[model samples]
Target chain A: MATLDIKVLGPGCRNCVTLDKATRAAVAELGLDASIEKVEDYAQIASYNIMSTPGLVIDGTVVSSGRVPSPSEIKDLLLAAQA
Target chain B: MSLVDTLPSSKGKLALVGAGALALWGLAYWVNEWLWDWVMYGVLKLDSANRVVETVHFFVYDFLKIMLLLAGIIFVITFLRSYMSVERTRALLGGKRSGVGNVLAAGLGVITPFCSCSAVPAFIGFVAAGVPVGVTMSFLIASPLVNEIAIGLLLTLFGWQITLLYVVSGLAIAIVAGWVIGKFKPERWVEKFVFETKLHGEAIDPSRGLTIKQRVGIASGEVSTIIRKTWPYLVVGIGLGAIIHGWVPESFFTSVAGKDNLFAVPLVVLLGVPLYSNAAGILPLVESLYGAGLPIGTLLAFMMSVVALSLPELILLKRVLKPQLLGIFVGVTATGIILVGYLFNAIIP
Candidate 1:
C-alpha cells in the first residue's frame, strides 16, 4: 500500500496548532504510515485555494479548511483515504 | 422499553441535551447577580460601602455574566454561521460591481466564518475568482469589526440601542470605505504576484452538507477555542473594569474625554488604531470609561478602531498591498470611525 501523504496548512495560530496536534494524535492512534507535513508559506497555501487557515489535505486532496476537525474525525478521514 | 430505547434517536437525544444545557445557561445568567450579591453581602457579611468588597463583588458578578454570555452567544453564532463560508461568500460576490457589491459584501462579512490569519489567502482567492477589490475590502473590513463577540458584549453591556448603532455604523463604514477605495483603481496597488498567482486544485466547500450533529460539534469546538484564546484578555479587561468602578471617581474621565471636548473622538480613535485586542477584551475598558462619563461616540470609536485597524493586521496586509493602498485603507476607515463618533456624540443624548 502506498504511504499516506497528509499536509496541514496554516500559519501557526492557535487553531493551526490545535489542528496539527489533532492530526498527529489521529495518525498515532491509527498507526498509519503517513507523512504529515506542515505547509505555512503563503504562496504554497494559496495554491490550495483555501480562504481559511488550518486546512487539511490528505494525499493532495483538500479535505477540510477553516475549522479544526476532531481526532476521531481525522481518523475517519484518514481511514477513508487509506481504503 | 428502557429510557434510552424509548428515546427517538441519537439526533433527538442530542437536541434534548442541547435544549437542557441552554435552559440551564439561561437560569444561571438570570440569577448571576443575585447569587453574587447573596454570597458577598448576605452570606459573608461584606459591607457594600467597603471599596474592597465592592470591587471583588463587581469582578465576580461581571466575570460570570460575561463568561456565560460569551459561551452562549459564541456557541449559537458559531452554529448558525456554520452554514456560511468564505467560499460561498466569494461565489455570491463574484461578478459584482462596486456599490451594490460593497453592501452585499459587508453584510455577508458579518455572517461569514473567517479568521484574520487567512486574510491574505482569502484576498488572493477572492480576487483571483474575479471578485472586485472594493467588494473584497468591504468583506474584510466588516469581518473583524462587526463580529459576534463585539455584538454580544455591546448588547450585554450597553443595551440593544447602542449595539444596534454600533452594528449599523460598522457596516456603513465598511461599505463607504470600500467604495471610496474602489474608486482609486486599487488593482495596481496590489502586489504584482497576487494577480499573477493562479490557484491550483479544486476549492473545497466546507460549508456544504453539514449535518446538525456536525454543526453542533463544530460550534462547541469553536466556543471552547474562542473562550480559551480570549480568557486572558477577558480577565485583564474585567479586572480593569472592577478597579475603575471601585477606585476611580465617576467623573474621572469627564475632564479629559467629556462630550465638551471636541478632540476626544479623533484622539481616542488615534490611540485605538495601534492597539490590537478582540472586542470582548476591549469592551470592559470601554464600558468602564463610559461609566466614568465618556461619551458613547468616543468609546465606540475607540472600540471600532482597536478591532478594525490593528497594527498587526496592517503588517499582514502589507504582504499583499503596497504601502500606498494600505495607507488609504487606514485613513478612510479611521475617518469614517471619527465621523461616526462625533455624530453619535452630538446626536445621542
Candidate 2:
C-alpha cells in the first residue's frame, strides 16, 4: 500500500485541532502509513486560496474547507484516496 | 533540562501569585484616589465646582480604571478565543434549516470574538462551507455587535441589567434580520466570482499536535497582539467618555435626543452608519451618551449601528455581495435596530 499525505490548514484553533485528530484516527483505523502535516502560517494558509481555516487536503487535492468531518467520513476519504 | 525547571512547582507559588495580583488590583483604586487628590486639591487647588478640574480628574480616573479593565478582560477573552476558530463555527452553522440556523448562528456569534474586520473572511468561509446566506448574516451581525469585549466593557461601565438588555436585544436583531434576509433569497446578490472561486493548494494545520505549553504561549501571544491592535481605540473611547461625563453640558444632548423625542432613535442610527469603529472603541462614547441623558434605546441603537452597520464593513462585504444584497442587509439591520431602540425606550425607562 502507498503512503498517504494529509495536510490540515488553520491557525491552531480548536476546530483545526479536532480535524487533525480525526484525520489521524482515520489513518490509524485504516492501517495506512500517512504523513500528516499542519500548516499554521497565514501566508501558507492563504496560498491555498482557502478563505476559511481548518481546510483538509489529501494527496494534494483539497477535500474540505472550513469544517471538520467525522472520523468515519475521513476514513472513507482516506480509503478512496488509497484506491 | 534547564535551570528554570529546578524551581518548585507548588501550591505556595500559586497562592503568592494570586495574592500579589489581588493586592495590586486593590491598590489601583487607592492610586486613582491619591492621584485625583494630589492634582485637584493639593497642586491645582481647584474646587469641586470647577468643571475643568473635574473633567481632568474624570479623565485620569477613568483612563486608569478602563485601561486596567480592558487589558485584563481582553487577555482573558483572547485566551478563550484561542479555542474557537471561524472554520468550526461555519461548520456548526452550515446546512441547518433557516430559522434554527439563524438562531444558532446568532448564539455562536455572541461567543466568537470576531470584529468588523473579519466580516469578509468569515462570510466567504461560511458561504463556501455551505452555510446559508441568512445564517451567515446573523453571525456577522451578532459577532461584532454582541462581542465579549464590548459586553465586558459595558458591564464594567453600566450595571448588569443594561449589559443583559444589550445582549438580548442584539441577539434578537441578528436573528430576526438574518431570517428576514433569508426569506428574500439574497443569494442572488452574491458575486458570481465567489461561487466560482476554487481554493486549491497544499495546506497545513499547525495546531495538529500542540502541547499544553504551546497553547498557553499562543494565548499569551494573542493577548499581546489584541492589546496592541486595540489600545489606541480604547484610549480614544475612554478619553471621549471622560469629556462627555465631566465637560459636556448635561442639557446639550437631552435638548436634542431626549427620551420624549420621537426622532432620536432613527436620527442616532443615521448618524452611526457612516462611522466605523469597533465595539471597544465606540462603547466608551456610548457610556458617555447614556450619562449625557441619551435614552437607553437611542444609545443602544446608536451602539448597534456603529458596530454593525458601518460603511467599511459594507465595503468589505462588497467583495462577495452585490450592491442590492448589501442594501437589503443594511436596510433590514437598520430597521431592526431602530425598532429595538424604540422598544427599549418605551419599556425600560
Candidate 3:
C-alpha cells in the first residue's frame, strides 16, 4: 500500500490541535502507512476552498471542515479512504 | 467525547431519547424559578428581601436559566446550520455589486456557519471569488454581531420587542457600514497578495450528503464544546450580575453612564472596541447594568462593539487587509454602532 498523505488545515486553533492528535492516534490505531501534515498558511487553506478552520484533507480531498470529528470518526474516514 | 456518542446508534431510538430530553428540559425551565424560590425562601427560611439572600437567589436562578438557554438554542442552531456553510454563502454572494449585495451579504452572514478564527481565509476566498469587499465586510460584521446567542439571551432577558429592535438595528449597522465602506473604494486598501493568490481546487460543500443523525451528533458536540469553553466566562458574568442586582446602588450607574451623559455611547463603544469577549460574557453584565439605570442603547452598542470589532479578529484580518482598510473597517463599524446606540436611547425613552 502507498503511503497516504493527510493534511490538517488550521492556524493552530484548539480544534485544529485536537484534530491533529486524533488523526495521529487513528493512524497509529489502524497501523496505516500515512504521513500527516499541518497546513497553517491562510492562502493555502483557502486554496482548498474551505472557509472554516480545522479542515481535514486526505489525499487532497476535503473530508471534514469547520468541526473536529472524533477519533473513531477519523478512523472511519481513514478506512473509507483506503477502500 | 460527547454523551451523544455513547448512545445507541439506532436513529429512531436516538430521536426518542432526544425528544425525551427536550421534554425534561422544558419541565425544568418551567419550574426553575419556583424551585429556586423554594430552596432559598421556603426551605432555608431566608428573607426574600435580604440583599445577600436575593443575590444568591438571582445567581442560582440565572445560572440554570442561562445554561438551559445556551444548551437548547445552540443545539438547534447548530443542527440547522449544518445546512449552510461559508463556501455556499460565498457562492451566493459572488458576482454581485455593492448595494443589493451588501443587504444579501448581511442577511447571509447571520445564517452562515463561520468562526472568527477562519475570518482571514474566508475574506480572501470571498474577495478572490469576485465578492466585493463591502459585501464581504457586511457578512463579516453580521456574522458575529447578529448571532443566535445574543438573540436567545436578549429575548429571554429583555422581551421580544427589545430583541426585535436589536436584530433590526444590528442588520442595519451591517448594511449601512458595508455600503459606506464600499463608497471609499476599498479594493486599493486590501493586501495585494489577497488578489494575487490563485485558488487551486474546487470548493467543497460540507453540508452535502449529511445524515440526520450526523447533524444531531454535530449539534450535541457543539453544545457541549461551547458550554465547556465558555462556562468560566458565564459564571463570572452572572456572578457580577448577581452582585450588581442586589448590592450596587442605582445612583452609581446613573452618575457614570446614564442617559444624561452625551458621550456615554461613544465612550462605551471605544472601551468595548479594545476589550474582547463573546455575547455570553457581556450580556449578563449588560442585564445588571440595565438594572442599575444605564440606558439600553449604550449597553447594546457596547455589546456590539466588543463582539464585532475585537483586537484578535483585527489582528487576523491584518494579514489580508492593509492598515488603512483595517482602520476604515473599525471606524465605519464603530460609527454605525454608536449611531444605533444614540438612536435607541432617544427612541426607547
Pairs that collide, model 2: A8-B204, A8-B205, A9-B204, A38-B205, A39-B204, A39-B205
DockQ of 3: 0.70
TM-score for the first chain in candidate 3 comes to 0.98
**Per-residue lDDT of candidate 2, residues B185-272 (tens digit):** 9889987655554545533233334333333444444455566666787677777777788777989988988987999999999999
Name the runs in model 3 displaced over 4 angstroms: none
Residue-wise lDDT of candidate 1 within B107-131, one digit each (tens)?
9999999988789989988988888
lDDT of 3 by residue, B18-133 (tens): 89989999999999969989887889999998989999999989989889998898898999999999989988997889999999999999898788988998999899888999
TM-score of 2: 0.75
Per the 3 Å backbone cut-off, how many clashing residue pairs does candidate 3 have? 0
Which ten residues in a row are the worst by lDDT in model 3 chain B? B1-10
Candidate 1 residue B140 Cα shift, in angstroms, is 0.5
Top-TM-score structure, candidate number: 3
Q: Considering only chain B, report the TM-score of each candidate against the true chain B.
A: 0.94, 0.87, 0.95
Docking class of 1: medium
Residue pairs in collision within model 1: none
lDDT of 1 by residue, A1-83 (tens): 88999999998888888889889988998889999999988778888888888899999899999888766678889999999
